[model samples]
Every structure is written in structure tokens, then in C-alpha cells.
Target: MIKKIIFTGGGSSGHVAVNLALIPHLLEQHWSVQYIGSEQGIERKLISGLEDVRYFSISTGKLRRYFDWNNFKDPFKVLKGISQAYRIIRKEKPDIIFSKGGFVSVPVVLAGWLNKVPVIIHESDITPGLANKISSIFATEICTTFPETTQYFRSKHTRYVGAIVRDELKDGEAAKGLTYCGFTRNKPIILIMGGSLGSKKINEMVWMNLEALLVHFQIVHICGKDQVNHSIHMHGYKQFEYINDELADVMAMADMVVSRAGSNSIFEFLTLRKPMLLIPLSKAVSRGDQILNAKSFKAQGFCEFLEEEELESERFVDMILGLYEKRSDYIINMKKMNADHSTSKLIDLIKVYT
Candidate 1:
């Protein structure tokens, strides 16, 4: 019998990224695929371009860390979402469900359990997010990007599968990257990625030190949505709200990267052997997962990290230059690490569970 799979995840691109990487491969193998995401999420926008994968939208609420009046309303929304997901899963009769651990997946995982279908949850951080923590009990298997994460789950079902990077990111050409950016080979390129939504403080720092930074390196800044400053267009600096198709080429030409410490992004940087300076989100705003992710990479000699709280207190430009000087050492450490065939491994696991 042909196998059909239901994929759920996404409040951000990170949650949906693994599903995106896996879906194309499954399609080639003639496995039927479908996605369950929020109606107006970034996932829907990202997945809309793909062919043959049917997309389903369901109600979802943000899993917040702080107080909000919506907190009371969200549970009801989640209950509604569970009903919606249960109905869909019952009708589709998928052999398996893959969740990347977002609020939307909570309902889907619960619904899958109600229908007696196997559900696999992929957690990218060292610690489980709120959504994954809630979904874990119902999950048949849990996949992790960090080996240390398995300690949190006593279940033998939890497997340490390394990071899943998109295949196309590895195919970038430096020449094409330079041509696209109108940059010369005379200087090193630094790519600043603040995440999908962008970082205000990072952008401000970049603008404040633009002249000093340009003296040493060419720069491409993916400054997040509506974060671009069109007023200042210098010879060596390029700023965009976001780049889709050209991101691979940008990665190809980037000698070093200044980015937020999100698991998927860091792993992609590691796979490309790009030296990185990671600035994790602060504990006040998040659950401190990025801080832990950064610490792990620092321990492994993969990158240098600065806490968001230290951005103002530290000599930011000096830190960037220091990282540039020691870039080769970081690359060496990264190269010494074994690379896992994560995408293939996950596919194998899915087949086993199915």
C-alpha cells in the first residue's frame, strides 16, 4: 500500500524548514504528502510554491511565555484546532504525522493520537519548546538536533538525528553571488542574518558602525521585514528585507556570518563551514533555548557567542573583527566534526515507524 504522510509545524520558518527539506525527497519517492499549518502563517506562504503537496489550514494560538489577556482565549482556540485536526486526520487516514514542534502541531499530534496514527516530533533545540513538551507524551518518536537533548526524554524512542539543511543551500556559486550583489572579490563578505523577523538592535548597531565595518569587509544584510534602511546606499554594503532564491548564493560568498543563534540556521552555517558570531535572544524574551544552543556550539568550537544583553556593553565591531581574524580556526573545528545525513536518516525513521 502507498504511504501518505501529514506534516505539521510553523509559527516561524525554523519550524517549517525541516518539513520543507523532507517533502521534496518524499515526493520523488512517490510518497503522498500534505501539510497542516495556520491559515495565515509564513509556512503557508513558503509551502504555496511547492507542487503536489496539498496544504490544510487550521486554527492555532501562540504559545506565549508571558502574560496576555489572550491566554484564556487561546486554550479554546487550541481545543477548536484539535477538533479541526482530528477531523482532517480521520478523513485523510495518513500512515504517519511529522511535527516540527510549533503551536499548530500540538492539536495535530493530539488529533493523531486520537486516531491511533503514529506521530513523530522533531525538536531542534537542546531543550524542548512549550509546544513539543506538550506533544511529547503523544508522540511515538522524538527526533533531536542536539545529542544532549535525548537526556531530557527518558524514552528509548527519542533519536538524535543531526540538523537537516536544505539541499539547495550547498549548491551556491561565489561568482554568481558576487554578480548578484555587485560586489568585488577585493574584500571579504560578511552576511548578517537577524532571523526571519529581523532584529532591531542588530540593525541599529550595523547602521551606527557601517563606516567602520565597511573599512574591513563587504556586507550583505538580510535585515528582516520592513527593517531595510533605503536612505544609505554605500558601495560595499547591500541591505534587503529578505532574500529567497538568492540566499544560497549569498551564503556561498559569505566568508563570515553574524547571525542569531537559532538551531537550524546555525547548523546550516556549520554545514557550509562559515565562521559565525552568534547573538542569542535574551532570556527575558524567550525560554533561553538560543542561549543554550549558542553555548553548545561554543563548547564544540564551532562559533563565538555574545548574549543580547552584552551587545551594548561589549565592543561589537571589535568582536566581529576578532572573529574574522580567527575564522580559519573556527572552520577547522567545524570540519573536524562528523557530518550526519540527517534528511536521509529522518526519512528512514519515518519509513520504519510507518
Candidate 2:
């Protein structure tokens, strides 16, 4: 029996959110759960007071593909993380290790492989992250969000599990969300999220053109924690520093969403069958994985993409209007795309491997 499982990943909301979704499923089966992640990452705060889960600190850091001073420090950091992971794994003696794919997950995964514990990795993006790519060799199963991801991994071990989204997103009603956001049932609602850390560019663009957007639609802007006050003033927009347990309500209520192309947000948009306008980060060093994630869904007609470079006030407004005009097409495509039940499939796979 799989008595215990160790989840490894952290550095972004994308990594932490998967674990949050999986926790209830694991508990339903009476499996003891523990988390191994960077002490400084968002996971620490998100899981700080969780029950029946042990959290271990690891000294992990990202290795930039570019030449940089930070790259020089990564080797030492990874080594330290590996040592900490080694100690934690030896002590926990977990039967299975589940990794959600981040640099922070590498050390614990390596330790699990060395200890002969089976490791399962879930890649949430259309493109796999560096940690998932390297860890694939040691992973017993490679679960992916999209079918296209199989081409990147060693063929036999990979499976398309779709994206595992929070149960709240799957269970909520759009009407409830609309009411919470104070929107009239007949009004077209627009939801804008810049990601967990917030996007300065997206915020600025919306601020500059707030009046125009308000003319046609009511907006619920999750401006991230830092920009809440400024974002509220910038457009007199209804803003939340963070939505807490209300994300699903907000998502369901919106007629459309404008968001950064982060894997987690994109998958959430798809899960809700919400039409979206994507603004991918243009910076080179950030991995800009969002661009690839957005392009993949766009190809399937599930959502529309707007490159950050091309995102002007006119273009942004035009895309929103276009989505409204062709709303039925977007809804049909979203339903087709949402046909896959990724979370339940993933839980079943874990049962098999365990």
C-alpha cells in the first residue's frame, strides 16, 4: 500500500496549485502527505498551516540558460538542495514521490531516484520545464497537460492527463461569480489577471485605456498583491489584491478573461471554458514559456493570443470586442477542448503507480 507520498515543486503559483488540487485526492485514499520545496518560495506561505503534511526546506535556485552572474551561483545552490533533499528522503522513507516540475523539485527527485522510490512528474505546460526535461529520465511516469507534450518526453512513459485544476474552478457557477463581482446579469464582464506577482505592462495598458473598456464591459481586475491600490486608482477598476477562495467565482462570472500566458492561468481559463486574450511575456530570460503555452491553445481555437509587443490599447479593445462578436465559436471550441477529465485521470494514474 502507498502509505505516504512526498510532493516536490515550488517557485511559482503553477507548481503549488497542482499540489493543492492533489491533496484532497490523496487524503481521500488515506495517504500521508509531505512537501519538499524551497523555503523562500511561495509554497512556504501557501502550505504553512496545512494539516498532516510535513514540509522540508531545500536550498534550490534556478539555473539561467544565459551567461549571468546568477548562473555561477546555481551549482552551489543545487548541491546544497540535493544534500538537504537526501536527508529528508532518508528520514521520510516515502513510497512514492510526486514532482510538479520546477528547479526546486530536482534535488528531491534525484534523492528519490537514488533511494529507489518511484518518482512521477506532471508537466503543466505545453512545453516542459527544464526540471521536468532532465527528471524525465528518472521518472516512472510523465503526466502532461497536452497531447503534444509526448513528443518531448521519452515516448513510453508519457501520458496526456490534461491540466489538474483546483476543484473550486470545476465546481463553481459563473452566475455566483458575477454576483460577487457586482456585475449585472446582462452586462458583458471582463476578467483581467496579471498573474500572482502581477504584470506591470498589462496593468499599465489597462490603466491607460480604462475608460474605453468600461464603456462596453464591467471589469474585475485581480491586480496582484502589490499593485492593488495603484491599479484601483489607475482605472477606478474593481480590484482585488488577491482573491483568496473567490477565484472560481470571479472566473465563472466573467464573459471573457485578459491574462498573462502562465501555464496555470491558461489551464484554469480552459477548465472554466472562458474565452481569453493572452499577453505573453516578451522577456528572454524568464523562459517566456507562456508564449508557447498560449500559442498551443490558440492553434486549437480554444483561446486567442496577443503578443506583448503588439498589445496596444486599440488591439486589446479590438480583441475583446472580437471575442464578444464571435462568442459562440469560442464557447464551442472551449467545450471540445474541455472534453478531457485530466484531474481524475491523473489521480487514477497515481493509484496505478502506487
Candidate 3:
């Protein structure tokens, strides 16, 4: 009999990439794949078009730490989601369930657990996210991205397996990237990314220093959806809301990366040996996971860190220049770093459980 697996995760790019890394392997092994996620989420958008993967959508409610007006209505949505997921699990009857934690995964996990299907979860940050923490009780195994995260999970099943890296990323062509932007090969390229939705502060800061940045480097800015400036037309500066098929090529041309420190994004850069200037989300906006990720990378010599507060200072451009000067060190450190992006460990567990 062919084995089957149901995958769940969503809400952010970080959560989505973990599941994606595993799907190709599962399919290669002839395991039938299914995905359960929110009806309207980034997960559905990311996971929908994959070959041989059947997607099931459920009504999920975001479980936020802070109080929101939706708090009153969210519980009902979550309960409904659980019921919907439970029915799907029963109908699909997959041999196992794999989840990378997000609010959507919580309901799917609980449903799979109650149905007695084996469930495994992966946590990609240095710390367990709130959704993962809540789902741990139902998970049979918890895979961690960082060694530091294992201690916090407190689960006998927790295993550290570094961040997942996509295989296609290794095929990026610098020439293809330059062709996309019509940029000169003489100037180094600086790629700036601020998550999927874009960061307002980073956008403002980049525009403010556009003249200074353009003089030193050609820039490819992935400024996120709806954040592009129509008025700014400058040579050697390419602004995109997002790029899919061309992303790998763009990455190949990037001499340095300026980005938010999400675990998925940073690990990809690390695997590519790209030196990065990390501007992590602050506690004011996030739970400080990005800050921790940035600090960890800095301590390991994989990247340089700048607090959001530091951007207001005139020295931000100088810091970027300084990071470029030390780029060799970052590449050397990252080259030595263990990269287990192939998902062999996670696949091993899946086979055992199934």
C-alpha cells in the first residue's frame, strides 16, 4: 500500500518553507501528499500549485498574544476549523501528519491527534513560537532548527535538524539576474528584502539613502506587496513587489543582502554563503525572535546585526559598507556551518512513524 502524509503550516513564509522542503522528498519516495491550511492564507497561496499535492482548506483563526477585536469571534472559528480538519483527516486517512507550526497548524494538529494519526512538528526559530508551544501537546515529535531551541521544547521527541534549504536555490545564475534588471556587472549588487508584507521603516530608510546606496551599488529591492514607489525611477535600482521564478537568479547577483532575520530567509542566505546585514524585527513589533536570530547569526559570524533603533542614526550606511568590507569573514564562517537542509532527518522520522 502507498503511504500517505498530511502536511500543515502557514501564516508566514517561515512556516510555509519548512513543509515545502519536505514535499519534494516525500513525492520522490512515492508517498501521497496532502496539505491542510487556512482557506485564505499565505500557505494556501504558496502550497496550492505543487504537483500531486491535494490541498484542503479549513476555517482558522489567528491566535494572537495581544487582545484584538477578533478575540471574541476567533474561538468559534478555531473550533470550526478543528471540526473541519477532523473530517478531512478521517476522509484522507493519511499514515502520518507533518506540521510546521502556525495558527492554521494548531487546529490541524489537534484534529490529527484526536484521530490517532502520528503528528510531527518542526520549529524553525531559536525559540518555540506560541502556536508550536500550544500544538506540542498533540505532536508526536518536535523538530528544531536551532540547538538552543531543543532545551525550550522540553520534549523527548525534540530533535535539532537545522533550517530547511530549497534545492532549486543552488541553480541561480548571476547573468540571468543581471539580465532581469539591466544592471552593470562592474558594480556590486545589494539585495534588500523586508519579509513578504514589507517593513515600513526599512522602506523609508532605504528610500532616504537611495542616492548614497546607488552610487556604491546596483540594488534589487523586493519591497513586498503594495509597497513599491511609482515616482522613483533611477538607473541601477530595480524595485519589485515579489519575484518567483526569477528569485534564484536575483540571489545569484547579490553580493550582499540587507534583510529581516526570519529563520527561513537567513538560512537560505547562509546556505548560499551570502553575507548579510540583518535588521530584525524589534520587540515593539514582534516577540523578539528575529532579534535573537540576528544575534545568533552575528555571534556565529554569519551576519551583522543592526537594531531598528540604530537605523535612525546617520551611521547606518557606514555599517552597511563595513559589513561589505568584512564579507569574506561571513562567507568563511557560514561555509563551516553545518547545513542539513535536505530534510533527511525529518524523512527518517516520517518513515519510522509511518
RMSD of 1: 1.3
lDDT of each: 0.92, 0.82, 0.89
In the predicted model 3, the residue pairs found to clash are none
**What would the per-residue lDDT of candidate 2 be over residues 1-354, giving only the tens digit for each residue?**
658899988887788889889988888889999999898887877777577788888999785567788888888999899889988898889888999978999888888898888899998887788888888988989988777878888749888877778886777777777667766766688999888778888888887778898888888888876787552543325888677677877787788899988888887887788888888888553676788888887898978899888988888888988988887898898887536677788877777766
Q: Order candidates by lDDT, high to low.
A: 1, 3, 2
Across 1-354, the per-residue lDDT of candidate 3 in tens digits comes to 899999999987778887888899889989999999988888888887696999999999988999899999999999999999999999999999999988999999999999999999998889889899999988999888888898987679888877788777879998999999899788899999998778888988988999998888999998888999888999889999877779889998899999999999999999899999999998897899999999999999998899997786367788888988888988999899766544787788889998
Q: Lowest summed-lDDT stretch of 10 residues in model 2?
A: 228-237
Candidate 3 backbone overlaps, count: 0
Ten contiguous residues with the weakest lDDT in model 1: 307-316
Query: In terms of TM-score, which candidate is stronger, 1 or 2?
Result: 1
Model 2 ranges with Cα > 4 A deviation = 173-182, 234-236, 283-288
